[model samples]
Target: MASSSTPSVRDHASGRLKRAASTLAEDTQSLVSEIKKAFTMVKNIAVDLEREKESTKVKELETLAVQLSESCDNCIRHASAIHTVGNEYQPTSELTDFKKLLDEQFMKLKAMPSQNDRLIRQFQEAVWNVHHKGQPMPGEEEEDIVMTSTQSNLLNVKCPLSGKMITDLAEPVRSMDCKHIYEKEAVIAYLPRNGNKKQCCIAGCPKFLQAHRLVCDPFLLTEIDELRSMNQQTEQAQNVEDFTGLDDED
Candidate 1:
């Protein structure tokens, strides 16, 4: 005959098995949630980077357009002066040649509109490289988690932007207006030039370029390069001091 406790022992074992199964299911669900959250975060970062890349390109093109317009104006002014001189000195060969050169320059200025599409395409390509492909997203750090399973799990992670190994993922520091992620120092360095001297670098924001603030992320070096180019143009314009300096004796 079987012992009286045999059925009770079986029941206890079955209950423990059901509880264990339930715990495992909960754990798996939690892990899935975490993975989903992580992927969403990464996607958001990519989008933000893309937007900033384009914005910077647009600003650069706009600045170039301004410079080109100024050049055209200067050419027009010179041409008028040549025409006046030609009228004063009726047979002046020099004034006639100058007028022809100015006409050619004017034609070139008119041709700039045709180049706009090409310039925009080039700018878009550049923005893509800066946003993706080469570097990791700014501010994110690689992390290694020791997930204990029935066996051991190991993961080798690298930062997307810097290619550095990091133990913890860094929190994103975003530009308040533009929501651009960058290292705090880099953001600060970029903020001063955005017109407000006191605002964030965001297009159309009332406080845009008004206040300077720092956030944390890898600085978009490509954006910095564009900014440097603009600065060089500005410096050159300033160094010229007077538009008539070319006609003046040094």
Candidate 2:
């Protein structure tokens, strides 16, 4: 039996496991934040072809973010299990030290650069496939190919419910159902809070809208900004041409 003041081996192991899980969760969250920041930067570049490539890279980053999030959830689950088992069951002589195992695995994960390499390889392969029309040279192995966005799936920036442009809305969200965007508050108001389904605001659309289906679309918001910037520049150039002709006439 353990002394009253001192923790038993089971209790000590449980505490160590909890700390390991907590550290993993925090670090995972920090990595997610960094990914978001990098995503924003990638979206801000002006060239169209470059933007397309960056978009592919961003998708890969998003996948990595999702994986890291799942890993964090698993860590939390494992920590909870450790707490439960430590409290209820007797600590056996051959009981696994999950803390040591997690620490070893976490250190290995941190040391591995294969994940980063894979992302870069996929990004490069996407760019190559785009340029080459997905045909590989005679000796090379086949790589995964990504298709460009088709015209029919593109979403208009204007909100279907309020007729407000994406740039004008304080918070814009996209519907995963019909690929339509809406002003977040407007759409929320349009749908009943009681969880009743509502028809999509856009005419001729068959999909139903629910609160869960609405997602924050940073990519759409970025596209809207790019479009607005291009339009402004075109108008400014036209104004310059008109002013030049007026001066010549004078």
Candidate 3:
């Protein structure tokens, strides 16, 4: 029932996530190379012609390059998150918001392939103005990217399960089996419902015991507290400076 016994769970998950990430990286590189070859073809043929056809082909290739680049980036982030959670962090399914977080992340990772395929089909059709059906590309539709540790934006950093600040920084705890930390209150709330047999929300290692025990992450908790205190002080200082500036203007 202790978090210390979950290394095997993390190790197995790490291997699988790494393999999947590797495959994705290889596939992306191959696709990018093909697109580059198309560029070479366009350049070679354009040298002998005084026609707009060459320009059109070049522009198409450029647009496809941008799209593929974005897709590749998203794939990498998702894979990286998977590896972090699977290997470095554990997940607890018992928390109220844990599954929701995973579902959101999964949707994004799933979208990458769709976007890639759509772009490929677009390239096959014309590569420039893709006239296709079904759902549009992620950016095209204006869907917001789900924030996670993988993103650098400050707004994205939060408890993965609760989608909120780790308010209980002093008493923060983690289900070691999954390696995910949660506010103590949030975790305790889950314990009453299922007792000590809750399953983890992580993709792999769905054992109930992983969610049954909780560990106080003092080091992590202290770090979170320091960040919170720093932000609070910064905000207070900014407010005072603004007040002083207003007085001077008056």
The most accurate candidate by TM-score is 2
Candidates 1 and 2, the one with greater lDDT? 2
Which is better, 2 or 3, measured by lDDT?
2
Clashing residue pairs found in predicted model 2: none
CA shift of 164, model 1, Å: 50
Candidates in order, TM-scores: namely 0.21, 0.39, 0.29
In TM-score terms, candidate 3 sits at 0.29
Task: Give the least accurate 10-residue stretch of model 3, judged by summed lDDT.
Answer: 145-154
Q: Write the per-residue lDDT of candidate 1 for residues 1-250, one digit (tens) a residue.
A: 3677766765665455444433443344344344334433433444465676656545555455444434433333333333323222223213346456546644644553332232233333344455464333344332211111011111212232333322233432444345433434344455546445554333344444323222221122212323344456457756776755765855
Q: Is candidate 2 or candidate 3 better by TM-score?
A: 2
Model 1, 137: alpha-carbon shift in Å? 24
**lDDT to native, each model:** 0.39, 0.55, 0.47
The 10-residue segment of model 2 with minimum total lDDT is 144-153
Best by lDDT: 2
All candidates in order of lDDT, best leading? 2, 3, 1
Cα lDDT of candidate 1 equals 0.39
Residues 1-250 of candidate 2 have per-residue lDDT tens digits of 4565345766686566545544554454445445535533433331235446566655655565445444433343343333333333434458677576545544544552323333233344444445474476335645422222111123666788888877688887777568788899999999998998899888888989988667553234434544565457458768999999999999
lDDT of 3 by residue, 90-151 (tens): 43433335345445655654553333432343333232223332344445542321221112
1 or 3, greater by lDDT: 3
In model 3, the runs with Cα more than 4 Å from the true position are: 1-164, 168-170, 177-179, 191-209
